[model samples]
Target chain A: MRQSTFNNKFLPYILLLPTMFILVVFLFYPAIETFRLSFFKVHPWTGATRFAGFYNFIKIFSNPEYLHSFVLSAMFAFAVIGLGLFFSLLIAILLNQKIAGIRFYRTFLIWPYALSPAIAGALFNFLFNPANGVLCYFTGYRSWLTDGRTAILVVIIAAVWKNLGYNVIFYLTALRNVPQAALESASIDGAGAIKRFFYITFAFLSPTSFFLFVMNTTYAYFATFGLIDVLTEGGPAGSTRILIYHLYKDFFVHSKTGYAAAESLVLFTLVVGITFLQFQTSEKKVHYQ
Target chain B: MKQVKMAVMMLIITVVLPFAVFANGGVDVDESATASIEFWHAMSGERIDLIQSFVDKFVAENPNIAVDVQYTGSYNDTLNKVKSAYKAGNAPDVFHSYEIGTLGLINSGIISPLDEMADKYKKDIPWNDFFTPVQSYYKYQGSHYSMPFNSSTPLVYYNKTFFEEAGLDPENPPKTYKGIREAALKLRAAGHETPVTWNLHSWYFEEMICLQDEPFVNSDNGRGSELPTKVAFNSAAGQKVLEWWVGMEKEGLFLDVGPGWANHRAAFGSGEAAIIMSSSSDVNRLTAALAEKGWEMGTGYIPRPEGAKGGVAIGGGSLWMTNNHSNEEELAALKLISFISEDESQIAWHKGTGYFPVRKTAMDQLKKEGWFEENPNYLTAFNQLLDSPESLNTAGGLLGIFPEARELIQSAIQEMYAGKPVKKALDEAAAKANASIEEWNDIMQ
Candidate 1:
C-alpha cells in the first residue's frame, strides 16, 4: 500500500472544521441539554426551572402507565423487526430471480421505501378502518382499531409494512453480492437448492442481515412516531402506547418537559444497550468478507 | 465608494426599520393609523372560509385595522404553538383556545384579561346577550379570560327510521341511561347489531358527570383556587356512569368506534348504529350525511342516570388575547373579538358552522329566520344549555393539567369498555390525573 502524506497538517484540521462544528451544534449540544434537563423540573408553558435530582426518573419508574409503555415498546420492536426481516428477505429472494420483467418487479418492490411513515400509516388506517374499510368488508365490518389486541396488531402490521421495502432493498443488494461460484460448486455437488442457499448464500448475507437488524431495531424504536401518531395516537386502552408515543404524550401533549426529557434519556440508554448487545452477539455470526 | 456606502446605508435602513417598528409595538392609536394584528385560530375547511369572510368584513368596516388570520391546526396543536411562541416572545396578538386550556394559558402569564376591553365596549357588544354557560366557562377567578367564540354541548343523535323499525317512539328518544338500554335491546331485537355508539372521548364522560351535578375536580372544579389539588371524577356518579357504559358494552348493545371522531360519525351515519352521543356542532354535518341515506335523524339532550338532575356543560373553543403586543394592537384585537361576538357575526357563524350561537340575540335571530323550524334538532342543545342549573358543576372544571387528565380518563374508559372492572379503571385514572395535577401545580405555583 502507498502512503500519502499531507504537507500541511493544518489543512486537514481546517477541512474537518465544518463537519465537527455541525456535529457539536446539532447532535452533541441537544443531547447534553437533554441530559441536563433530565435532572431538573421545568414548567412547559412558563419556562420555570427547578433542579431536582432523580425526581423525574423516580416519577416515571413509579408510574404504572410508564412501565406498561416500556413493556409495550419492547413487544412492538420485536414484532416489527421479526416480521419486517422475514417478509423482506422472502421478497428479495423472489425478486432476485432471472425471470422476464425482473427489473420491473425489482423497481416495484422498492417503491414503498419512498413513502413517508405518516402516509403509510394513513393508507393502512383507511384500508383497515372498522366501518367501511376494504378489509372490514371481508371481516363482516368489524371495527379493528377499537379492540386492544387487534389495534396493536394493526399498528405492528403498519410499522412492518412501512419498513419492508427498505429491508428488501438492503437484502437484495446483499443477495446479489453473494459469491455465485460457491453456490455453483454446491449445485454441482448435488446439494439441494434450499441447502445450498442456507449454507452458502445465507452465510454471505449474514453481515448485511446484521446491519439491517440494527437499522430496523432503531427504526422500530424511534422512527415509527409519525406512524403511531397518525394511526392510533396511543389509544384503545393505551395498548399501542409505546415508549416513544408515551414520551410524546408527556412532552407535547401534557407539556411535562422535564419528565419527557427524562423519558427520552431512558429511551436513549435502551437503544444504546440494545445496539451494544447486537454487536456482541453478531461477532460470531456476521461474515466479514 | 460613495455609491457603495449609500447602498449599504439603504440596505441597513430597509432591514432595521421593520424591526424597529415591530419592537416599538407595531401599532399606532392615531385615528388614521393602521393597527396591524395577527389572529391565530384552529378553524379549518368551511369554517376557515367563514372566519375569513368575517375577517374581510371586519377589515372592510374598520379600515384603520388590518387583521391577518392564520389557521394553526387543531386545538391541541394551537395550544402547543401558542405556548412555544409565547415563550419566544412572539405569540400572536389574539388566538383561539379551547376552554380546557384556559387555566394553562392563564398560568403562563401571557394572557390579557378581556374584562377591561369588555367594559369599554359594554354598550355596543351586548355583553349580557352572551349565553350564561358559554360566558361563565371562559371566566376564571371572577374575570373573563377569553371570549366565548364557538360553544357546543353533547346531544343524543338517533336514527328515527331505526327507532320506528325497533318499535320505539322516534318523537320520544331515550331520556335516561336505563331508557337507552331498553331502546338498545329493542333495536337489537329488530336486527341491529350495534345499536349505540359514541366517540371515544373524555368530553362525553365529563358531560356525564356534569349531568349528575358532580365536580370533576376539587376546589369547585378548580375555579375557587388557582391550582387544583386533586380530581373528583372517581366518585359514585363517575363510577355509576362507567358501570352503565361497561354493561352496555358487555350486553353487545354498544359499539366501540375507537377514538376517531369520524369513526363514530360514520357508524351513526351509515345506519350501522341506531344511536350515538355527539356534539351539537355535528348537527349540520349529520343532517347532511343522513339525508343522503334518506334517514331521519333525531336529537335530544345527553341522557342522565335514573335520578340524576344536572345538565351538560358547554364544550368548544374560545378567543383569547395574548399579552405580546402594544395597547393599540390589544385594542384592535379586542375590536375584532367584539365584532365577532355581535349578533350579525354570531348568526352567520352559527348558520355557516353548526356550532351554537354564543349570543342570545343570535339564537333569537336564528329562530326568526325559521332555522329552528327547518332544523328542529339544533334546538335541543340550546334548550339543554338554557335549562341547566346554575351551579359550579355545570360550569365545567378548570385545571392546569386538564388535557392530560382527559387522556387518562379516556384510556380508563377504553379499559372499562374492553371488560376491565369499571371501578378499578376509574380509580387508576383518577390517581394518574391527580398526580398530573400535582405536577402541574408544583411547577406553576
Candidate 2:
C-alpha cells in the first residue's frame, strides 16, 4: 500500500483538501464553538456573552429535569437499538430466503427508510391519536399520549419503527454476501438450522451488526429529535424529553443558548464515549469474511 | 463545450440573479422609489387569505410601497425564524410575534417602537381607538413595541344541543368553576361520554391566575419599576385552580385530550365532549364544524372559580417592526401596520377570522351592520375584554422567559395530572422558572 501510494505528496494533500476543509469548517468549527460556549453565558438574540466557569455544567447536572432526561435518553437509546437490531435481523433473514415475490417483500421492507423522522412521527400520531384515531377504536378511546409511561412508549415505538428499515437493508446486504458454502457444510455436518445460523451465518453478520449498533445508537441519540418534537414535544411530564430535545428546548424555546451549548457538549462527549466503547468491545468479535 | 458553457452560465445567473436584485433593491429608498418590504406572519389557511386580501388592497392604494406578506408557520416557529434572521441580519421588515415573546423581543433591542409612527398616523389610525387590553399588553416601560393585531382571549365553548339534553339552559352556560362541575355532572348523568374537555395548555392556567386576581410573577407581573426577580405562579390561587382541574380529572368529568387544541376541537365537534375551554379565535371554525352536525355552539367567558374578582387577559399575537431598515422602508412598514389596524381592515379581519376586532370603531361598525346579531358568539370575547377591569392582573405578565415559563407550567400541570402533588409540582416548576428568569436577566444586563 505504501509502495502504491502517489509519489507526489502535494497531489495527495490537494486531493484530500476538500474533505479536510469540509470537516474543519462544518464539524470542528461548531464543535469548538460549542465547547467554548459551554464555559460562558450567551444570549440567543442579542449575541451577548459573559464568562461563567462551569456554571452551566453545574446548573444542568444539579437540575432534576436534566438528570431525568439523561436517564430517559439512555433507556430510549437501549430500547431503540435492541428492538431495531432484533426485528431487522429477523426480517432480513426471513426476506433472504428464495421465495416467490421475495424481491417485492424486500422492496416493501425498505420503504420506511424513505420517510423522515418527522413524517413518521406525524403518521404514527394520527394512527394513535386518542380522539377519533384508528387505534382508539380498538383501545376504547383512551388517549395514550396523556400518560407519561405510555407517551414514552409511543415515542420509543415510533423511533424504532423509523430506524428499522435502514437496519434491515444493511443486514439484508450482509446476509446476501455471507458465504453459502460454509452454511451448507455446517448444515450437512448434522447441525440443525438454528445451530448453523448461530455458528456460521451469525458470525458472518457480526461486522454488519456492529456497524448498525453504532449507527442506530447515533440515530436514537440525535436524529430522533424531529420525531419526539412532532409526536410528543417532550411532553406528558417530560417522559419523552430526550437529551437532544432538552437541548433544543433550552436553545430555541427557552433562549438559554449557553446552557444548551453545555448540554450539546455533554451529549457529544456521551456519543463519543459510547462509540469508543462499542469499538473497543465489539470490534474483536467482528468477522471480516 | 459551448452548450455546457451556456448551461453553466444559466445556472450561475439563476442562483446569483436574485441576490443581485435584492442587493440593488436594498438601496435607492427615495420618495418616488418603491420600498419593497417583507412581512412575516404566522397566519395560515383562511387567515392568510384575509391577510393577502388586505396586502393587495394596501399595495393598490400605495403603489410605491410593495408589501409582501409571507406566512411563517406557527407562532413558535415564527419566533425561532425571526431570532435566527435577526442574528443573520436579514430579518423581515415586519413580523407577527406572539404577545408572550414581547419582553424577549424588547430586550433584544431589535424591535423599533411604534409609538412615534403611531402618533404620526394618529388622525388616520387613532391609537386610543384600539382595545385597551390589546394595546396595554404590548407596551413595555410606557412605550408600545408592537401593534395589537390578532388579539383573543380564552372562552368557554359549549354545545347547545348537549346543554339542552343535559337539562341545562344553553342561553345560560356555566360561568364559574363550581358551576361547570355541576353542569358537567349533569352532562355525565345525561349519558355524555366525556362531559367536558380542554387542551393541556398553560395559557388557561395563566388566565385562571388572572381570574383569581393573582400575579403570575413578582414586580407587579413584571410591569413594575424593575424586572421581576421571581415567579409567583405557585400561589394559593394557582394551586386552587389545579386542584379543581385535578378533581375534575379524578371524577372523570374532564377528559385529558392531551396537548394540541385540535384534540379539544375534535372532541367537541364530534359531540364527545359537552363543554370545552378554547380560544375565542376558534369560534368560526368550531361553529362551522358544529353547524355541519346540526349542533349549535354557545360561547361564554372562561369559567372562573366562585367569587374570583379578576378577568381574563388577552391572548394571541401582535405585529412588530424591525429596526435594521432604511427610513423609507420603516415608514412603509409602519404604513402597512397602520393600514392593517385601521377600522375597515379590522372589521374584515374580525369577520374573516374569529379574532376580536382590536379597534373600538370596528366593533361599533360590526354592531351597526347587525353582524353580531347573527353571530352572537363573536361578541363574547369582545364583551369579556370590555368587562375586564383595568388592573395589573388582567394586563398579563411580562417576562423575558414567558414562553419558557408557560412550558414549565405545562409540564408541572402534566406532572400533577400524572399523580404528582399539585403544590410540589408547582413549586418545582416555579423554582426552575425563576432560575430561567435570573439567567435571562443576567444576559440582558
lDDT winner: 2
Query: What is the iRMS for every candidate structure?
Result: 1.4, 1.3
RMSD of every candidate to native, in Å, equals 9.8, 11.2
Can you list the residue pairs that collide in candidate 2?
Answer: none
TM-score of chain B of 2: 0.91
Worst 10-residue lDDT window, candidate 2 chain B = B116-125
Q: Write the per-residue lDDT of candidate 2 for residues A234-259, one digit (tens) a residue.
A: 99889899999999999888888888
Q: Say which docking band candidate 1 falls in.
A: medium
Candidate 1 at A251: error in angstroms? 0.7
Per-residue lDDT of B1-445 in model 1, one digit per residue for the tens?
9999999999989998676556444334554557999999998898888998999999999999999899999988988898888887888899998888988887777788787555543323455788889867877777787888998898999999999988999999888999999999999999999889897788988999999999999998888855779899999999988888879988888987777788889988889898999889999999888989999999988889988889778889889988767766877898898888888888888888888889888888888889999889888878989999878899998888889888988899888877789889889888888878887787887
Highest-scoring model, TM-score: 2
Q: Which stretches of candidate 1 lie over 4 Å from their true place?
A: A1-26, A141-143, B1-32, B116-125
Question: Candidate 2 chain A: minimum summed lDDT over ten consecutive residues — where?
Answer: A1-10
